[model samples]
Target: MIRLSQDNAKSLLAIHGWSGALLGLLLYAVILTGVIAVFADEIGGWSSPLQHEPATALPKGLGAKLAELSTQVDEQYHDDLFFFPQAGGRIRTFFHKDIVVDGQPSAEGVEFDLDPNTLAVLDRREGISETIQQRNTAGALSAFLVDLHVRLHVPNPWGLLLTGALGLAMMVAAVSGLIVHRHLLRELFTIRCRRQDLLAKRDAHVIAGTWNLPFAFILAFTGSFFSFASTVGIPVVAMVAFGGDQERLIETLVGVSPAEDKTPKPLADLDAMLADAHARVGVEPSFVSIAHYGRADARVNVFTPPSEGHVSSNNLVYDGATGAFMHQKPGLGLVPSAGGVLFDLMGPLHFGNFAGVLSKAIWFALGFAACYVTLTGMLLWATRRAESQAWQRLARATIWVGYGLPLSLAASPIGFFIGRSLGIVELHDSMAIAFLSAAALAGALALSLRDLESLRRVLLAATGAVLLSLPLLRLATGGPGWASAFASGLQAVFSLDLAMLVGGALCVFAARRPNARLAAAARSGIEDNQSQPA
Candidate 1:
C-alpha cells in the first residue's frame, strides 16, 4: 500500500541485497545457534538430569542450611546471597559481596553446591564470580550453545561488539527488504517454479523473508540491545550520572537504597517464602535473592520465570526478617517507567521463552525459517555473480557453513556424555575441542569436494549419523534408558531421544535427494556417473 520513488526503491534493494550478502552467513550461524538454544533448559535437563526432579524447585530446610553456612563465611559476605538450581537440579548458593576486581566490578563470594534433597554441601568454591562460575558443571552443553549464540565464543567486549554489529546488519536487511518489495502481497504467494531457476530461488527467498520480517526485526533489535547494554549502555549511563560508579548504577536500577541496619536477626524461613511465591504467581521462582542477609532491613527478591499468558517474568519482594509479603516490582528502575518496561520485554521477545515449550517451539520454527532466508539469499546473490572468483568463494563458504555447522554441533555432546560418565572435570574443554575438531574435518570435506551439493549431502549425512547415535551414546555413558526416564517422569530425556531419532532419519533422507537425481540421470544416460565440480 505504501509507495517509494524508483530511485528510493533501487537504493533500498541495494541496501537489502548488500547487507545480507556481506553478513548473511554469520547471521545464519547466529540464528541457527539461537534456534538450538531455545531448548537450552530442556537440553540441560535431558543431558544432565538427576534421578528425578526435586519435590519443589526450591526445597524445604534451605533456610537452616543457609544460616549454618553463613556462620562459616565472613560477615561482609552476607551483604548479598542468592540461590538457584542447575545441572541435575542441584542447588547453588552464593553468599557474596560485590567488589572491584582488577578495576572491574565483580562478585567475590563463597559458593556451595548443595544436594537438593539432603541439603548437603556437595562442594564449595570461593573466588571471583567469573572464575568460580567456570567450575560449574551445570547445563554444560546448554551453556556452550548460549555462549556461542550470544558472543560467538569470543571474549568480552569484542564479542559483544561483533554480535551487536551483526544485529544491526540484520535490522538493516529486514527494513530494506520490507521497503524494496513493492509487490509484497503478490510476492508472498508467487512461486515461479516453472520459470528460470534464479527466479524460482528469488521467489522462495521473498516468500520466506516476507513471512519472517516481523520476527527478524524483533530479534535483531532486542539482541542488539542485550549485546550493547553491558558494553556500551551501562558505561555511558555510569559516566553521565553515577560518576562512573558501576555498582552504584546497578543499585539505583535495582531500587535498593536502604538505611544500614546491621542488627543481627534470625533469617525468616525461606521455604515459607518460596511456597508463598508459588501460591502468589502459580509458578516457582527461577531464583531467590536476599540482600543484607541477617540484617534487620534485609529484603528478599523472588524472581520467577514467565507465567502462563504473560510476556515477561515477575519479581515478588518479601521481608527477609519475617517472611512477610511485599510489593511485586514490575520495572527494573526504582520508579516504574516506559524505558524499564521496554527493557523487561526485551528478554522474552528475543529469546521467546515467555510461554515455555510451545512458544519456544514456535520461535524455533521461525528461527529456522530465518536461517533459510539468510543462507538462500546469500546463495542467490553469489549465483548472479558466479563468474567472479570472490563470489564463487562466498558461495562455497555459504554451502559449508550452512550444512557443516549442524555437523560440528552434533559432535559437542560426544564430549559431554563421555566426560560426565568418565568423571572428567574438564567437560567444557572436551566439548570445545570436539566441536573445533569437527569444524576442521568439515572444512576439509568441503575443500576436498568441489561439488557444492555433494559437500552438503556428505555433511548432512554425517550430522544425521551423529544425531542418531547421541541417544545411544548417552545411554552408553550412564544415561537412563527410555523406560527408566518414563518411570521417573523425565519427559525431557524421552522427548529428546525421540526427537533425535526422527531428526536423524530426516537428515539422512534429505541428504539422499541429490543422489536420487543423479541416479535417474545416469539411468537415462543424460550425464556421466562421475560427479562434477562446481
Candidate 2:
C-alpha cells in the first residue's frame, strides 16, 4: 500500500474527487460509448446483415473487379487504393489521390461498396474523404457511436484535443484514487450493507474504483495516445523531423518511398498476393492498401488479423507491379523494433480484441463497472453539498444524464431503423435528432417527477421497451429474422437480437426491483437533493 503524509493524502483525495466530478458526465459518456464500440464490427453486421454471408472477405474475382473499376475512374485516383470488408459483408474499395484542399493535403476519392459474393457494385460515392464518409449508410450506426466516443461529435482537431485532455484527467483521477485510498487492496472486496446510505455508496464507489484503477489508467493512457498521435504527436514530429512535410514523414515511417515510376503498368493480380499472404500468415487478410497503384513502383500492404495464440498481427508487403511477396513486417515499421512492438501492442491493449469475443465481453463488463463507479462518485459528491442550489441543480443534471443517456442511446437506433425504412439518405442526422429528443424528454421527466426513483423507473422502462423492440424493428426494416439469420450463417444478427432481449429484460427487472437502501436514500434527498424543480 502507498504511504503518504496526512496533508498529501488529503490533497490527493481532493484531486481525485474534483477531477472526476468536474468532467464526470463527459467522461462517462466517452467510456459508455467506447464499451459499445468494442463490438463495432458485430454492431455493423447486426445492423445490416447480408442475405447470404460471404465465404471470404474478398471474393475470387476481386482483382478483376478492381481492375475494371480502376479503368473507369480518372488516372489521378490511382495514387492510392484501399479495400476492406465493411458492414454487411460489403467490400469497400476506395481509389483516391492526395490533393491540396484548403491548404491541407486531403484525399479526393471514389468509393464503391461491392457485394462480396457476386462482386457487383452496390453503392458508389465520389468526393473528398470526409464528405464521402458522411454519405456512408452501411455502417452508419457503428460509425455514429465511434465518432461520439472519439470526438463527442465535435469537429476534428479540437475534438481530439478535448478528448485527449479528458483522458489525462482520467489518468490523474485514477492515480489520485490509488493514493487517497491507502487500503486499496482491502477495499477491493469491502462493502458494508449496514452502514449509512452515504457511507455505503462511498464504499461501493471505492470498491469499484479501486478494482478499476489499473484498467482505467491503461485505457486513459492508450486513449490519449490515439487521440493525440494524429492530432498533435504527428504534427510535432513532422515539424521537427521532416520540416513540416507530412507526406515525407509518412513515407519515411511506412518505409515505402521507392523512386517514383509513374509509367503505366498493369497492376499485378491482387488475388494471388492475398492468397500468398494467407498461406504465409495462416490468417485471413483484414485490410489491403495499395500505394502508387498501376505504377511500376506500386506496393501493396495486406494486414492480417492476429493468428491463433498471437497477441499481435503482421502486415505482408508485396510488389504491386509484380505480385511478388516482398517482406512481412510489424505494423509500425518495415522491421521489428522496440517502438514498433510497443506501437502494435496499443491497439489490442485498448480494444481488448486480441482474444476475440471473450476478451471483448470482459472488457465490456469492466468498462460498465468503471462507468458505474464514475456516476456514483459524482452523485455522492453532489449530494454532499445538497444545501446549495447549484449542487441540487447538479444533482438533477446528474440524474438526467446518468439514467437518461442509456435511454437516449437505445432510442438512437430507432431513428436509424426509421430512416432506413423511409429510404432517407443521411441517417446520422435522423439519429442525432432522435438522441436529442430522448434527452430532452428525459430532462423534462427529471424536472416533472417529484422523486429520483420515479424518474429512474420511467427511464429504465423506456430503455427496456425500446431495446425489446429493436429486434422487431430490425425485422420490420428488412433485416432477416433470427431463424433465417441463423440458417444463413448470420450469427451476429441472431446473437445481437438475443443479447438485446436479455439486456431489455434485465433493465426492466432492475427497475421493478429497486434497491431498498437506494430507494430510501432517494426519498431522503441523498439521490436527488429534494427533487424540487432542481
**True lDDT of residue 290, candidate 2:** 94
Cand. 1 Cα-lDDT: 0.84
TM-score for all predictions?
0.92, 0.95
Question: What tens-digit string does per-residue lDDT give for candidate 2 at 1-534?
Answer: 889998888788789889988898888888888898899989999998888888999867899899999988998899999999988879989999988777656899899999998998989999998778878888899899889999999987889898898899899988888888887779889887896666677788889988888889989999999999998998899999989997788877786578988888988988899999999978989899999888899999999988888878879889999999978877785677899888988899899899989999999999998899888888777777667779767777887898899998888888899998999877899999999999999999999997776788888888898899999999998989878898889978989999999999999998897666555554455444444211
On the 0 to 100 scale, the lDDT of residue 421 in model 2 is 90
- Residue-by-residue lDDT tens digits, candidate 1, 1-534: 459997887788788889988888888888999999988888888898777766766888888999999999999899999999876677889999999877767899899988787888877888888777666665678888889999999988888888999999999999888888888898889988775445566788889999999999999999999999999999999999999998899998886566888899978888899889889988888898999999898999999986777776889999888889988887578767898788789999998988778889999999999999898888767666665678878878888899889988888998888877778754788889889988898899988997777888999999999999999999998889999988877888989999999999999999988843322322322122122210
* Shift in Å, residue 201, candidate 1: 1.5
- RMSD of candidates 1 onward, in order: 4.4, 3.0
Backbone steric clashes in candidate 2, count: 0
Total backbone collisions for each predicted model: 0, 0
What is candidate 2's local distance difference test score?
0.86
lDDT of each: 0.84, 0.86
Clashing pairs in 2: none
